[model samples]
Target chain A: MSVLVVLEQRGGKWNRTSFEALAAGQKIGQALATPVTAAVLGSNIDSLATEAAAFDIQKVFAIDDAALEQYTPDGYAAALEQLIQASTPKVVVFPHTYQVRDYAPKLATRFRKSLVSDVVDLKTVSGGLSYVRQLFQGKLNADIPAEGDLQFVSIQAGAFRAAEPASATNPIEQFRVKLDPSAIRSKPEAPYREAQRSVDLGAAPVIVSVGRGIKEKENLPVVEALANALGAELAASRPICDNGWLPMERQVGSSGQTVSPKVYFAVGISGAIQHLVGMKGSKTVVAINKDENAPIFETADYGIVGDLFEVVPALVEEIQKTKA
Target chain B: MKIIVSVKQVPARDSSLRVDAQGKWLEEADLTYEMNEPDAYALEEALQLKEKLGGEVVVLCAGPQRAAQTIREALAKGADRAIHIEWEERAAPDALTTAQLLANAVKPESPDFILTGLQSDDLGYGQTGVVLAELLGFAHATIVMEVEPQGDAVRVKRELEDGWFQHVSLPLPVVLTIQSGIKKLRYATLMGIKKAKTKEVKTIPASQLGIDLNSGLVMERIYLPTRSKKTQIFSGEPKQAAHQLVEKLKFEARVI
Candidate 1:
């Protein structure tokens, strides 16, 4: 009869995407005429629960446990399983994040349910709901109908706006989970950053990014020449960085840096939803690829359906001439 | 150490897709298939571990009869043997059902560890590995970037968002979903291909697994994504299109 949105936080700082999940939950709750509740699991997360309570939800559950401080699949899943058993929410929503991807499926499986993951949109038909998620690396969209008594769904980033905080103050409850120390496997060490990020692509005015279309590591210079000519930072999709052709810090996608430069030149990159979500904020996106139906073209403002090898060099020369 | 690598066969990355007449799946005709890219990395990781530790590497795949091609590619790349769970359904089963079938197959091997791609290229569920681990009562980690075996446990480096990584330690009988590009994939050699043809491939029908195929979630329809923006395409010679793009960037968009 109610919707439960799980909010994720690390070291007591909210992962902004949690609000987007709240927004999605609120919309679903209104549509179904049900109450909406939220829960944040961590040690010393009372403030987080209070912050969430101000967001127009009916109640906030602060599930605190000393073992839940650092994220472990066993600890979080076990804790959430207990919470769901106690509350019995009809629908569960989460933000499709790396942390969620790690453990949400395991939690859902415990209840004989499968999570409809990375959902981009939702529709109500005949008083029932269907979730839309991308397939074939975002080449196609599949509509999955919502069935079963308990439904677990995760919303994609940027699919919903963050819920606005209101003056209404709701009740906050402290739910204690009995977690056994021995049951928690996978001891986690401190998280660390590799190779201090030297170039912040976020501040750049223009960025020229490459993808699998470049073909070989030897051909990278073709795109580098254009980046140099335009005075733009050179970035690349996950495959380029995974190949070690480009440094990991220069990668753009869900796991890498998210940039919003004024102009994003996607040279030979067929847009996967992972890469598209990172650079979709660019003011002007220009894509150069041989395939006209590449998903990059769907988000691009201007596109050239031709070989990047031939188009990039000519564009570099034109930009240099205009600068002169 | 005995490692079982779970792989999948998906349509080639460059294939043009058409919806099937039922609108429930892709058209099978005129489609080329290849080993799922992420699973290729998983196989490579397993092969490397086998080489270092001098144990067996087994590839486990679940698909239609065509999946045997992908299994051969894995064996050629250096797996000791393979297990194929023949599933001929047109529409893929949900993640939970797929994991249950895999768990039933993997239970007999009792491998020291299991490795699979973080997600498949086709369904992109990204949950089968973890769910498989749970069904088998094993500890698990996803997005694993590195793995080093200890006496009885393994230490793995897992990728977090925004370029952060955390090192985790788990005991044997664990499941680790490998991130793509963790290691370079080895191509199938003529000699290895010959050996692969002779290697053991045990085929088990899905019905023999005795797991229910009915999935809770149902695919209502499939279609191309709607365009969010109006893209003005310049189609012609490469030089002419480049010139037109520069003109638009300079004047119309004013980004330059």
Candidate 2:
């Protein structure tokens, strides 16, 4: 029995979810007594392969197809399905990303297999495995198990710890998988990059996110200054985006980018499940909300029940003094 | 153009829930039920469309008998007719199965357009509409915020990331998942509510749909999160204090 994890990458680098999926697959692999194999599909994935090598991965199946240079659900599903059948993995893992979301179900349906997606927890069941998923926007939890072979699941980003690279020296060998490019039906159009995605907040270790509590659009300078002072990225809640206070990429939620920054300081943000699903996996959640009963406090590791306007400047001053 | 809207009754958004001793699902008691918020929004959109374009609005639901209350409430709010699938055997089945039951009922009406809330409030899988689109082989767009109907096709605006919106036109026999709160729900009129008691609410069972995909997804266990005091406070000179907090946040907390 072996575990196969499909790592999501773009332009050779791993996406934010790759780290989470890798760690989760390793966790399951260790319990199953099988080595986790990583699958990379693209024209090239040097950086991703190097990152995968640091993990407890036994082998990296790197398939380079021009058809895969850009992601199309049909191409991705076909390639992953091929590698999956060839590897004969007991379980197939993927990051719950937009790219994966579009095609994971299609692939699952093709094989007549069930796909348990956005998994929050996992355990080895009596004869197999069981997983926990959020129902109704995190208001409820539903634990389900795989009843058939070739089990498939997509891990929500930040849901699991990005386990430190394996202790022992693990050799990383790349395996080439044969592909029939002609079989790809939909040739991707010229990649149209979103003009505003120049700054990817996912890589920022420290993010200072402002919520609706920030009050007015003019008050954004406070959070921006705070972010600048701490050398952190600025993020926002869905409301802020809905009102045009910030760019869409800056919004954190289930539909937006799921972030796992080292320090996520939330200001004026009421913790809605839609927003919590995006940032709950952060290493440390610090919430500054005047409302003590705010749900954000539940997941917040450190919370100050006070006005963000009063708290932000005071905290920024302390940081400047330390810099001096 | 007649429009048919399918809605579901679900636990209120604010209802507190917990797993019972059995662990198969959340405690149903002590929970208040309502018309699924998004579905209410869809029904409102349909009523408005019917008002503007001169047609009839039909509300369809698939559930047990208690759901009649929700259907009647819709009728009171102005739906011309109501269909409730009375399934005593299955409390809740997956979307594809439910779609078969809904499609079996709604197909006869031969409405020009069909709309449903993005997903059930209880199971926020956000898949039912898309799956329904595939099952019915109708063009579909999820996350639809605004909709306008043409003679042969329908135009819809989809919500995208970063405050972006796209408009697309899909030919008839299309399904569009309605995003909640595009407009506020209209209250049932006192006169309409009185007349609603006389409207017909039909009931059917799942066994009648006749299509089967083994229900592999089953609710096995559920539990609430353990309560813990997780809070931190930072003090001192603004800049330096921010630096210290940033250090703790990055190395120790890692939320940045």
Candidate 3:
């Protein structure tokens, strides 16, 4: 049985997580002792297909159609269903991206098959493969076993690192599938950057980020003072940005920007998985929150179990004194 | 116009999670339950649409009997009625099974629109909405941040990763998974709560849906995440800890 990896591309360039999914596909192929084929979908994606050909796999299947120029659940699902039906790969893999979240389920349902979404890891069990997925916002992980001959898996973004693909001089092939124009019931507009992003937090040497524990918006200056005292950039979790206390550009999380500042100070952030993936790469992480049991403590290098209102002011004063 | 909003009951955010004895689910003996956060947003979106378009808004849920409380909450928030699909205790159904059951429960309604949470706070599979759409054969969108109804189509704003947004127009009879914090949720007032007692909630047994409950994925194990780092806890007065933190930043981390 062969394995198939669905490569996601927009316009022409590949989505960032495509490589991650390919890496996962390679690993799964190795575990299952099967050859892996990566398929690129969309119209005029020859450049992408050429790029994917470099991967250390069998062949890159470029499935192109005019109806796929823009992403719509119905259009992509119908085309992919035809491809899967014809090829009949034992397993299909995808990167658990927003785009995949929109269409993978629809594609799986067309075949009456179950889809295992947002998996973090996979293990080779005695019988078959078991995938690990998180529950309760990362509090618990469940090992889910596949139930059918044909299965679908979506690897979470950042779950695997993209490896260097071996050069393939002749590994690119073109495949076509029919998509009914009348069946596509949605018209997509051009994607746009919601904000100009005045502040690029990823480049900052130090970042001071706050969360719901910071209390009211009026108290934001407390953390801002700490940021200023250390010459660090001001950032926040989703709630702070959602409340308009900080601009959307200042938000650091999955839906926001991913930052790897040198020294990251997370004041009162509970370290939800969505927020953790963005800042976990920081060189040094220090978290301060009144709740000692907050999940932030699990990842922080140094943790202070105290009120941010008191701890942040003292921190600012100490930093100012040290500079003086 | 008619709308069906799917909601779920989950452990409250503040509840401490403990692995059950079987190591396949949570120990919920004492945990408080509340409406899944994103599903509440979806219900609010449906209610707002009904208020604007002068249509009927019906709530649908699949869970244990305890979920009736969640259905009542949606009814209190102005859902005209509710349908609760009662499942066996501790039934760990995968996304497709759940979606199939929902599709079965939703067949008789044939509503113009269906709305659901982007994902549940508990399982977080985040695939039910799209699966339901495909099973029911409707145009669908996920992470919908805004919805504006046209005559026979709806223009929706969807949130993409990394602060990007997309606008799409989908024909009527569509499915949408609402993003959290889309709009302020309205509370159930005393009068509304009293009226909710009279609202209709029709409970259907999951076995009767004719969908195979055992035809989906199986959970082999569930456990707490292994800690990746050993945190050094700072112990002292708030000022003293802050002073030490600053010193460490200057010397150890050398960032400031």
What is candidate 1's lDDT per residue for A177-291, written digit by digit as tens?
A: 9999899988999999897889888888999999999999999999999999988999999999999999988988888889999899999899987898789889999999887
What's the lDDT for all of these models?
0.91, 0.73, 0.87
The worst-scoring run of ten residues by lDDT in candidate 1 chain A lies at: A121-130
Instruction: Give per-residue CA lDDT, model 2, range A170-258, as digits (tens).
Output: 55555555657664433333433245675577788889999878889999998998899878989998667756768767878765677
Better of 1 and 2 by DockQ: 1
What would the per-residue lDDT of candidate 1 be over residues B95-119, giving only the tens digit for each residue?
Answer: 9999999999999999998999999
lDDT per residue as tens, model 3, B213-232: 76688888998777778887
lDDT of 2 by residue, B1-256 (tens): 8788888988775566666788766677867889997888889989988888888888888877778889999999999888787777536666556666677777777777788887676776555655555555455666677888887777777654323456656677777788765766789999999989988877766567765533656767766543355566554444444556657754675443
Residue-level lDDT of model 3, residues A1-324, one tens digit each, is 778999898878778788898888888888878998989999998888888888898888888889889988888888888888877888899998889999998888888887888888888889577888878877678898755778899988778898566887547777778778987899999999864777888899899999989879999889989888888999999878866788878989989999998989999898877898889889999999887767788779888899888888988889889999
Clashing pairs in 3: none
Q: Ranking by TM-score, best first? A: 1, 3, 2
* lDDT at B230, model 2: 51
Clashing pairs in 1: none
Displacement of residue B108 (Cα, Å) in model 2 is 5.2
Better of 1 and 3 by lDDT: 1
TM-score of each: 0.98, 0.68, 0.95
What's the TM for model 3? Answer: 0.95
Instruction: Name model 1 segments beyond 4 Å from true.
Output: none
